[model samples]
Target chain A: EPEVTQTPSHQVTQMGQEVILRCVPISNHLYFYWYRQILGQKVEFLVSFYNNEISEKSEIFDDQFSVERPDGSNFTLKIRSTKLEDSAMYFCASSPPTDTDTQYFGPGTRLTVL
Target chain B: AQKVTQAQTEISVVEKEDVTLDCVYETRDTTYYLFWYKQPPSGELVFLIRRNSFDEQNEISGRYSWNFQKSTSSFNFTITASQVVDSAVYFCALMDYGQNFVFGPGTRLSVLP
Candidate 1:
């Protein structure tokens, strides 16, 4: 079965540095999302992208975060400046065009900011 | 607002034991979707099941069964004769017509052999 795939399975960056997490969603999916889970914490929604634009974002998705669908399959999340608290597992998910389609998740990229 | 709650933080069981994980959700929209995902020690989100608001029928797939109760706003998952491979953190999520998903804290299950 086709699945969402993310690049750089693990990333390590210094605080104040920039980081970009990339994802290649399923080819036919129309909606994409980014989520983060702090170690031992619940998964938190960051932002959702549809039609190459942000559809909705949570409070945690502040000024430092931005998402882009630069190409047909590539969706990326960029953090301008990383913080120590940013160390977590970032997941990329995508869903079909259906209203009630289930979002398929990627293996996740573990971001470690020191 | 959409919210999902998984009350059990951790649950442990020996092999072959049946365990149930609880999920309660709060969503005003009559149309919504509920899902269950498994995260093993490998730290990957594995899709397990998904149920829409209109379909309340309980479903069973092999050793896994889901109970959807729209009246009580609950979707519970039960694992029958679970094995060591079933050990994982289970997450219950809720999503409405909106884009984002609201995930529960998750329940970690350690199935010992």
Candidate 2:
């Protein structure tokens, strides 16, 4: 089965620095999403992208965060300025345009802001 | 508002035993989807199963099974004869038809020898 793939499985960065997390969604899927989980907390949604544009975002997705599908095969999440609280595991998911199809998730990028 | 609650924060079971993870959700939308996912130590979210509001049928797929109760607004998962490899965090997600996303809060399960 096809799975979403994320690069740089783990990243340790200094606070106030910028970081870009990348993901390659399934070949034919159109809807993409970004979610994060603090070490012991629930997974939280940040943003959703469709047709190369953001369709929805949560309050947690503030000015510091942005997402881009710069190419047909690559989806990226850019954090302008990282904070210590931003340390968490970031996951990328994608699903077919059909409402009933299941969404495939990547292994996730573990971001640690020190 | 849409919410998914996995009340049991942690569950410990011995090998060869059966375990059930409880998940209760709340959503007013007439059309929605409920899903179960597993995240082992490797931290990869594996899609386990999916069920829609319109289907209340209980489904069993080998060692995994799910019970969907529409009236009670609950979707529960059961694993039979669990092995140590089953140790992982399980998540329940709710997705409304009108929305473009899913809401998840997971339950952690530990299998002992």
The candidate that achieves the highest DockQ relative to the unseen native structure: 1
lDDT of 2 by residue, B1-113 (tens): 88888889899999999999988888889999888889998888887887888989999999999999887888999999999999999998887876634555688899999
Displacement of residue B49 (Cα, Å) in model 2 is 2.0
- Give lDDT: candidate 2, residue A106: 94
CAPRI band for model 2: medium
lDDT of 1 by residue, B1-113 (tens): 88898999999999999999999999888888898989999998877888889999999999999999988999999999999999999999987876457999999999999
Residues forming the 10-long window of minimal summed lDDT in candidate 2 chain B: B97-106
Model 1 lDDT at residue B37: 88
* Top TM-score prediction, candidate number: 1
Model 1 earns a TM-score of: 0.90
lDDT string for model 2 (A12-98, tens) is 999999999999999999999899999987777788888879988888899999999888899999999999999999999998877
Task: Give stretches of model 2 more than 4 Å off.
Answer: A97-100, B97-104
